[model samples]
Target: MNPCDTMLADDEAVIRALLNEVPFNGWTRTALRRALAACNRDPDDAAFLFPGGAADMIETWACLADRDMEAAALAADLAAYRTPARVRAIISLRFEQNRPHRDAIRRAIAVLALPQNAKRAATITARTVDSIWHAAGDRSADFAWYTKRALLGGVYTSTLLFWLRDTSDTDEDTIAFLDRRLNNVATIGKTRKAITDKRPKLRIPMPGFMRTWAERA
Candidate 1:
């Protein structure tokens, strides 16, 4: 199969194989990371890494996201159906960080137990979602879990992505965003309980043109 067109499952296996073959480090590792980043928006830019002249790995990565999300959600082994929003958040965060450890997943989710060193990021908060998965081992990672989990992942990635793109100091806007989202999620279920099933209409603050632009984006 063309390396470029390989799906994430295939890519994961290849990466695993490469790691086993040699020390997967140095310039080669960095190159692979950059290639993965560019593969989605600009596949041909990293086509040199692949055997065939034309193959798109990014599409397969997205396919992997879909593939794995569906697989895990449907599987009995996983605790519950992880929401699509959570999956997107995980993918987005993973892309932003370039690498993440599995332990980090535990902190964002309470039910899922994690190793002690897993989420030891310096000054990291509980809301920085580490995985796009439901809590396993003993109970269900239901709607409440999924919603909270999605909020955590979405807030962090959105904050960081914009922070990286932003040319400002202190990342004040990003922090503010985190605070606002945290407060919203924190109260949503509580408020919903009091209201007893009152549906919340998500408001779009942007003007008509901006709304359209965001959707297209």
Candidate 2:
């Protein structure tokens, strides 16, 4: 077994234990210590495993969720659906994957919403939206790449907040809300293309920062 793979497995084990305690203790070091104990990991390893403390733990968990969502998308044969439908399905799948950890997610949002964690929050959101687009089979290497992720980021964020408060059975309300938002985006895209069709074509170069991000993606 590779050292990196061993480390990831250890991280996942501790984090999975951490989730069980997050609802009761929030994302504090105390909860993490307990999680370390539960996983039979040395309590002192907390610092070594998550040097950024709660933020690192949350980010790792989000990364795990992204991988799970990608696996779910592939298993679902997302290629059979249209792009919009594929996006919707992927989002829905994410909600389902995190359904059991809803409270932990709420706590995570609160932590990420803090003024100090703004950059981490944005990074996590960007990664998640990018993952969703990739899972939906988007291979665009142009300006639309950024636009699509930005658009889905908004939809995913809004739906996530709505989902945290949703009481409808099986997230029926959240799914409907997501569908409406996706439809609105589609409508706007169509209108913009129609208007652009009548104007002179312009090539917009991808920004340096976005290009860097794309390369990392």
> What C-alpha lDDT do the candidate models reach, one value each?
0.40, 0.86
Any idea what lDDT model 2 has? 0.86
Q: Compared to the true structure, candidate 2 yields what TM-score?
A: 0.88
- The segments of candidate 2 whose C-alpha lies over 4 angstroms from its true place after superposition are 1-7, 201-217
Q: How far off is residue 128 in model 1, in Å? A: 11
Question: In model 2, what are the clashing residue pairs, if there are any?
Answer: none
Off by over 4 Å in 1: 1-56, 59-96, 99-139, 149-161, 168-173, 196-217
Instruction: Output the worst ten-in-a-row residue range by lDDT, candidate 1.
Output: 104-113
Candidate 2 lDDT over residue span 1-217, tens digit each: 2222234777788888999999999998888989999998788776666777788888888888888899999999978799999999999999988888899999999999999999999999998998899999999976567777788899999999999999886888999999999998998889867755765556546469867877865
Task: Indicate the residue-level lDDT of 19 in model 2.
Answer: 93
Model 1 clash pairs?
A: 103-118
Residue-level lDDT of model 1, residues 1-217, one tens digit each, is 4222454454654333322222233224344444455334333334445332111222222233334444453453433424434444333444333223122222222212235424432113232242244322213343345445546655654555455544444445555565576566668768856554543444424457645644554
